[model samples]
Target: MEQRHPEKRNDRNTDLTSDQNLKDRPERQESDKAEQDPGERNAIDSNPGERKPAEPNAGERGSRERNRGERQPTERTSGERQSVERASGERNPGERNPGERNPGERNSGNRQGNDRNQRDKDRNEGVADRHEPVDRVAPDRMAGEIAREGRRSADNGSSERQDRSAGERGPADRGTADRGTADRGTADRLVVGITLGDYNGIGPEVILKALQHNRMQRICTPVIYGSMRILNRYRNILNLKDWNLNGIQNISQASHKLTNVITCWNDQNHEIQPGKVTTEAGQAAFACLQRAVEDLKAGKLDALITAPINKQNIQSEEFTFPGHTEYLAHEFGVQDNLMFMVSETLRVGVVTGHIPLGRVRSSVTRERIVEKLNLMYQSLKLDFGIQKPKIALLGLNPHAGEEGLLGQEENEIIKPLIKDLREQGRLVYGPYPADGFFGTRSYRDFDGVLAMYHDQGLIPFKAIAFDEGVNFTAGLPIVRTSPDHGTAYDIAGKNQADETSMIQALYMACDVARRRKEHQDLEANALNPKQVVEK
Candidate 1:
């Protein structure tokens, strides 16, 4: 306001000066013609001081005023100025009219519209950022994040909100809308095949006991792949009538509906007694596993969870595979097979399996070690839901050779592998001695450990997680997992075995199945972005 006064006053003063300056025009005819108007002549005669001030440039002053009035002001009236700005903003879009709209209203309306559009644009941008993929993320952890987000959004207190809604409906008569968009589909019916490891062991007993709980029905439609007679025999021995087991020939027989009962797949036709280790029992267990793998290959079963299998028993004249994991690896034609033994606290991945102890040092290579580390990382991601997994490496020597004082395996080979992996931006550590490191509290600092051989890892792993360890096969095209402990023939049919590991294997299998599906979906989306579009 203060700055505007000088401009207004200057215009007034210039007008006065211009009038007086017109008194001394070079064109006497034009000057006298102006004086002929009585009002102009009287004003000029009365204001002699003003006339004297402008007498030097009368014609120039009159012409300059006429030109100045032709141009538009950079800023107009307080109200028209706003119009000029808004109109200038929109004015360049096309032509303009002198009287198209009232200046004040047009400015305010346009400003309001611009503000609203900017706010909406910002809001939409914020929402668009929520769906972008976090690169290199683990599959299970991504699922957990999705589930937690869903649960968080469902807990919006809509029930309490309806209490104060004051609608026509009574407050006490509100339906249960509390669980909006919750984990209903997440806890849906997933079909998983549980293959009894070996009939001579606790495989049959654990399968029967694990199905006794009704809560398992809520998570998945579990199917026992062994004989019906074997399953019922264990059920009879346990004396539990809560089997709730449905006999199905294939996936078609089992209901694909949600919240369904457990389905038992009767694949074999052999009658075997408990505490017996015969060739017939071995063949029956093998056939059950075969059927289960066939279904898995055909996409009928999401994943296969083996209870336990004895390597020696599976080594009949007809059957000659080391264990369930190796046999499945061979069946699936898997080359990059990694055996991951998992406890609640620690997980161990074996670089080489079932080889002689003498060959352990030679089997550890830079490429093989690197591949094992990569598999362990991916397995921890998909199977266990671990994000940013940290892996520890165990040396082949006694004390990691005290820097090759006892053996040069760590210094010659393992150290180079560690350097390359670190350079590749992977989180990996150690090459500590096998026994010394596994026996200490340092195992807690890692997500998985790479052991040189089988017993080097299994000894401490089983000591810590005796009954709860689960063996997970990594880098397979499909999800394959099993119980960590072997088939126990001593306690077979005795009903003295525990089913905790078997139950964990089933849960882990289901989780891996979901993860595999999710990973496939992500890959599909990445390959064809047009398949997914926002509304």
Candidate 2:
């Protein structure tokens, strides 16, 4: 051969294309074929020093034979481009000289190279391309689909693969989030019907403040049976302009997503002065309570959390009952309901609630005491999820009637009921002196406590759980709770009313509803021994 200059040889080496080299050495064709698959391509690319077998097409094989000592261009495949890039040690084919062939196969151009680099980083960090880009149109996200895919992944016995398949919103995370939302919406949703107790009192203020909590929306839907005008006035007075109230025609129309208000009375002439109790306010309160009660009875509401009503003002032919407790009893046709006050720490129920103290002695009959104890026991079991609750009874007289010396009620009625209940396998305890029973915190020893009258049980309960106490009405067909504190007319407009009690009442109402449903479900499925029980 004629002598070629050293510089010319170097230029030829630099200019020689991969196909030319392949043609010059036809034996190299088999190695290129083995790395055609994208997965195999990635494996080979991960370790560029490792070589894979390749197989050339018949045309290329023939071209290699024909051009024994010459060079020629030929059609390029993606595998060929990858092979050429690998052989040339060009890490990114996209950055190759523009004069090079098959520039599209490596990555695309400058922009695409950057994108591929980022994608490679993401892949290295365990973020694979399982999901489409957010800019792309995607199908709706269904809870069932997410759950099924998760189960399928888990069943495959590769937790890493399962997580990869699930991407960021994995089966467990998405399923929990979606199921939690759905359960809160369906099963745990307490559609609380809130009656605006004397509109002029702290009822509207406390209701507004309590419902304003973001967490309230997650647990229960609130339907305020009050006037929009009145709520707006209070909202403005309390500077709670940020809170939005959805006005609805009826309870059925209330929205679960927002605090709904069903207008019970919207007379512009009616005065709405905070800290003042008026007949109009009482009538409005009664109207709201009446409407809410109707809905509650009609099954539109899960629970009823009443605000306080003025005993003197809210009395007319429409509302002749003493208060919410007596009114609810008559409405439900229950002769008496247990006035159960509940907190996280303790539970207290009274034999005579909302009745005069003088009449309390007469109300402390053996039948009444037994009835209240039975109601309290049942409430502790069903409403509170206690299987066999221990109960303590308080004396009507000081020091438990001093062994019948101070009074005869405790010895005459209370102790006999306790004795009979205990003999019947009930976990009923003593008629301990009210002062000492609560004074020494002995009430904490038992699951529930029964008092002869209102103040007897409530005084200690409020003293301990004042801001958190919830007044629950037991023995009624429906669930009803109220804040332990009454309507504070003095602090109604001033915004001095603490929302803790109302919030607790709302929480208790939802919990009681859930417990009642759970108890009913257990009763219904009691025969099935193998059935899975929910905790």
Candidate 3:
């Protein structure tokens, strides 16, 4: 599981000047009302016994007439004056008591002020409580300003919402979330065959690390195809002797609750040297892979997850392909297969694999591109359960040929093919520039990406998803996936190799197997609608 980082709050102070302006209207006169001391009112009552009612002086009478004349009767209606008085928390001019206010009117200004203060408090405390209804009594201008402010707040606080929801749902719900709710055929456990590649490299180490416990058995019965002697040699070096290596003679004898191992060859006289690729080590790796492939072909295994292999040393008359993808394609008699890389978040396929850069341009023909696209389109719908997959096609030249100035592949080949595919009801798009497409993360909006060459796709895919990338061979009769990496000869026995990618490859094999079965069942039932198929 990937660890989530904490969300950084927008600690910058909010600028509420517009809202403050509305609260300080001239008619309300909050300053004057606040300045009037309560001491003056108490003083008037304290001397009631000695006080005498006096006639108005000439200055006071003149001042009263001037105050009354300032308000034209039509302009300053009694209702408007009362409204202002209620907002300012002041008694009417003719009221008998200093603390008295109109019975029908309350201090709306004071109530609004309290609400604003509470909102500020909640914001500073990092709380977004939507239960409090918005203040409708506030003026239209103030309400508009507040609504915009709320939107800004929501945007700033949206980063960790998914994490927060997961937290609320608790661990059980998180486990279910990890296992998606897609209608993935039957839930039966698959028998996944694991091939040990280049025992001298990090292959054995990662295999041990990936299947250390019985958790994987819940999904599939893993059968490791390699020499038990070689596995023990690496196990002793890495101090993993406590892990079980349940030995089995064949796939049928494998145990579901243990890490089953099937020794494909005897290693009594073989040498064990870490971080070194030799003919003996390569031969042993080939022996294990050949046995596993044979078993898989005979229906003894549901899927195959191959570890990393050294291409040069593994070359022989029996296995004479560039890499695993090519070798598997040949073994299955497949003419066209896609080198599709799958991760939790992204899926990428290349038009050319294990070929020279000089030949990339020539290899990227319309027929070949369409062939890879058809394989990917079917893989997405059947192997991945996506109904209508959207695919992004990358250009052969830089900046997608720049309108034929840099290259003409995009204009002549890619664009025309895309138009044809779309007309045929396939949701394919673009000969987009490779750098901009991956750099801007536009790939996330689509289901898959088809790069024109090996380095163009694998370079970025490994850089971004090296820890969990699974190389799957699409359009093959059988399912085969391997970690998207070669034998790390340098870090072979250092006990430092990360097993994340191998683990992901195993899980991906199981998922793809289940999806393929489900898809086949659906197709069969569709063809024979009158006959019901058993799960």
State every prediction's TM-score relative to the real structure: 0.62, 0.65, 0.64
List, residue by residue over 178-292, the lDDT tens digit for candidate 1. Answer: 1221234333446788886677678877777666533344345667777666666677777754424555566557642211222243435555566667766666677778778
Which residue pairs show collisions in model 2?
A: 29-54, 30-54, 31-53, 31-54, 32-53, 32-54, 33-54, 33-55
Best to worst by TM-score, what's the order? 2, 3, 1
For model 3, where is the 10-residue window of minimal lDDT?
Answer: 6-15
TM-score of 1: 0.62
User: What does the lDDT come to for candidate 3?
Assistant: 0.72
User: In angstroms, how far off is 258's CA in candidate 2?
Assistant: 0.7
Worst lDDT run of 10 residues, candidate 2, spans 130-139
- Of 1 and 3, the candidate ranking higher by TM-score: 3
Ranking by lDDT: 3, 2, 1
- In model 1, pairs of residues that clash are 21-54, 21-58, 22-58
Which model is ahead, 1 or 3, in terms of lDDT?
A: 3
Residue clash pairs of candidate 3: none
1 or 2: which has the higher TM-score?
2
Against the true structure, candidate 2 reaches a TM-score of 0.65
lDDT of 2 by residue, 273-327 (tens): 8888788998898899889988988898989999988988999987788788988
